[model samples]
Target: MPETPQLQVQCDAMIGSLHINADFTTTHPWTVLFGPSGSGKSSLLRFIAGLWKPQESHVILGADNITTTPVYKRKIALVAQQPALFPHMTVRENIAFGTESNQAESIAQMFDLFALNALADAKPATLSGGERQRVAIARALASTPRLLLLDEVFTGMHRTQRDTLMQQVRSHCVAHNIAVLAVTHDLPEALEADEVLRIESGHISAQGSPHAVLSEECTAWIQGVTSLREKL
Candidate 1:
C-alpha cells in the first residue's frame, strides 16, 4: 500500500473576532484539536478544508500545496456538528451522493462499517440524531478523502453511542491510513485521540500525547469532581 500523506498547516489570520495563528503537522492518524469554545479550533479545520480563506495560509497535504484548492477538489471532508443530510435522499443514497463513482462493494462496506444496514432505505427525516451522524460520516468516507475534519460531530450523542462510534471510526481510519483531525472540547473525546493539539485564544498552545498535553487541566477537573463528591 502507498504511504499516507502528512498534513502540514501554517495559518495566521484574524477570522472574525478571533486571531488564529497555527502551525503544525499531523503526527498521528487520529489527532484531536482541544480547546474551549471560541478558541478557533473549528476555524483551523475550515482553513484546512478550504471553506474559510485566511489572509496568510500554507496548507500542504503530502507533497501538494492545497492552500488555494477549491473545496470540492481538495479531497478533504469536513463533517460539522450538524449532519445536514439531504431530506429527499435515503440513507444509502446519501452515502453515495458525493462519490465520483459509487461502487456497489464500497457502498456496502460503508453500510456495514457504520452500522447503517437497518437504515438503508430510511430518509434523513426518519433517522435519529446519532443515526444521521453515522450516515454523514459514512458519506464522507465514501468520498475517499485524504483527510477527515470533524467539528464536534459527536456532541449530542449519548456517551455510550458516541464512544462506540468513535472506536469504529478510529479503527477504520487507521486501517485505511486516512488521517483525521477532529475538534472537540470534551475531555473524554480528546483523551481518546492519538495526539492532542491544545488551542488557547486562537493559538496552538501545545501539541503532544493527550496525557502530557492535557495533564494539568485533567488534574484540575478531577480535583473538582472529587471535591464535589466530598461535599455531597
Candidate 2:
C-alpha cells in the first residue's frame, strides 16, 4: 500500500448557537477527535463530508483541493452513530451496496473481517445493534474510501468488543492506506488513537499524541475509577 496522505481542514461555522473554528491536519493514520457533546466535533465532520456548508471552509485531501467537491466525489466515507443499513437488503447485500465493483473477493473479505458470515442472509431488522454497526462499517469500507470518518460508532459496544473491532478496522485501514478520523467520548478509545485533537467550546484546545493531549483527562478518569472501586 502507498503512504497515506495528509488530510487538512480549516473551517469556521455556526450551528445553532455554537461557534466552531477548527484548523488541523491529520499526520497519523488514525486520529481521534475528542470532545463533549455539542462541541462541534460532528459539525466539523459534516463540513468535511460536504453535508453542511460552513461560513468559511477549506478541505484538502492529499494533493487535491477538494473543498468544492461534491460529497460522492470526495472519496470519503462516514459511518454515523446510528447504523443506517438498508432494511430490505440482506447483510451481505448491504455491505456490497457502496462498492462500485461489488467484487466477490472484496465482499468476502468484509464478511470475514466483521465476523458477519453468520448474518450474511439476515436483514437489518433481525440484527443486534452491534451486528448492525459492524455491517455499516463493512459497507463503508467496501467502498474503498481514501478517508474514513467515524462518529461515535462504538457508543454502546462492550469495551472488549470495541477494542477488538477497532484493532481489526485499524489494521484493515492501514493495509489499504486509508486515513481515519474518528469521533469519540470514550477515554480508552481516544488513548488508542495515534493522534488526538481535544476540542472545547467548539475549538481545538490541543492536538498531539493521545497521551500528551489527554493526560489530565486520563488522570482524572483513573482517580474516579479508584474512588469507585474503594466504595464498591
Candidate 3:
C-alpha cells in the first residue's frame, strides 16, 4: 500500500427503495458530497465506510478491494452528526480508546491537532457541541484510519467554529494523505473541499471543482454564485 491511499468507489445499489446507483473515483484528500436534504448523500458515505454493505458495491482503497470487508477491518472511521462518545470517559481517555496500539505519540498528536489539551479531564457531559465534535474527529484520526467519513458533523456549530475545525481537520488529514469524504449541503463546506460531487435525487448528477459544479447547480441564480465565490 502507498503512504497516501486513494479511493475508487464503483457502486450501484437500491438502498431501501431509493435506487442510488452511481460510479465515481476520488483521490483528493478532501472530497465533499454536496446535496440537498434526503438526497441519498449519507447513504453513499455509509457504503464507503462499510456501515451498510450494498448487494452490489465495491470500495477500492489503494489496491485492496473492500467489498465484503467488515467495518472495523476497513481502516475507515466515521464521525456522525451526533458523535456517540462514552459518557463516562474523560476526553483524553475517549481519544485513547480502540487504538491499534499503545502509541502515545499519536494520542499526543491528537491533543495538539484538535486543541484538546486543556479539556483532557473534561467529561462528555460537560463539553459543548463543538467541543464534542472536535473530540470525535480527534478520536477518529487517532485510530489512524486510512479513510475518514464525516456525515454532517458540523451541522450546528457556529460558522467560525465550524470553519476553524474543518480547516484544522482537513489540514491534518491532507498531510497524512488520509482520504476524507465529507457530506454536506452547505455551499461553504463544498467550496472548502478540494473536489466536490453534486448529488441530486439519489444520484451523482455532477462532479468537478466546487465552483464548476455549484455553478451548474445554480446557473439561473448567477448572483448567488458570485456572492458565494466572494466568500472564498
Candidate 4:
C-alpha cells in the first residue's frame, strides 16, 4: 500500500512556566491526540491552526509549508469544544460566511447532508448543544479545508449526540478526503480514531492503533465512567 499523506509539525512552546515540545507526523485518516489536561494537546492543535505561533517550528501539510501561513490562508478549519458560532448571524449565513458565491448551493447541500436544513434559519443562541456543533461543523466544511482540527468537540454533548457527531465527522472527512487531527482526553473517543497518540510531559509517549496504544490501565479507567456507553 502507498504511504498516507501527513501533517508534519515540529515545535516548542511555553505553557505557563513549562515548555511544551511536540514532534509528530500523522498519516492516519483520523489521528486522535490523547492526553491529560495541560498536556499541550490543545496548544498543539492551536499551533497547527495558526492560532498559536511556536518559538521555532515548521508545519508542513502534504508538500506545502504553512509555518508562517495566516490562519485564513492555511485552509485549516478548527472546531473547538465550545461552538464558536457568530451570535449575530443566522445559521445559513454562518455556514456560508467565507465560502464563494458559486459554492453556496454546494455548501447548502453539504449542510443538508448533516441534517442542518431546519436549523439554517435559527440563530446560534437558540440552538441546542448538538445543533450548534452540527452547524459549526457545517460551517467548517463550507470552507473546503485541507484539514480539520477538532479540540474536545464532544464535550457538553450527550452520549448519543457525541456518537452521532463522531460518525458524521468521520464520514465527512472520508468523503471529502480531508485529514483530521482530533484532540481529546476521552479514551473511548480516541478509540473511534484510526490511530491514537498519547501525549505526556510535552511529548508523545505512545502512539499506534487504538488496540495497540491504549494501555490496559487506561482501558480500565475509562470503563469506570458511567458516561462511556460502549467499550473501546
Query: Whole-model Cα lDDT per candidate?
Result: 0.90, 0.91, 0.87, 0.84
RMSD of 3: 3.3
The segments of candidate 4 whose C-alpha lies over 4 angstroms from its true place after superposition are 1-4, 222-232
TM-score of 2: 0.96
Clashing pairs in 1: none
Predicted candidate 1 versus true structure: per-residue lDDT over 13-65, tens digit per residue: 99888889899998888899999999999889989999888767899998899
Clashing pairs in 2: none
lDDT winner among the candidates? 2
List residue ranges in candidate 2 displaced over 4 A. Answer: none
Worst 10 residues of 2 by lDDT: 98-107
Scored by Cα lDDT, where does model 2 land?
Answer: 0.91
* Candidates in descending lDDT order: 2, 1, 3, 4
Cand. 3 TM to true fold: 0.91
Residue-level lDDT for 62 in candidate 4: 79
Per-residue lDDT for 168-228 in model 2, tens only? 8999999999999999988989999999999998899999999999999989999999999
How big is the positional error of residue 114 in model 1, measured in Å on the Cα after superposition? 1.3
- TM-score of every model versus the real structure: 0.96, 0.96, 0.91, 0.91
Candidate 3 has an lDDT of: 0.87
lDDT score of residue 151 within candidate 4: 89
Candidate 1 colliding pairs, count: 0
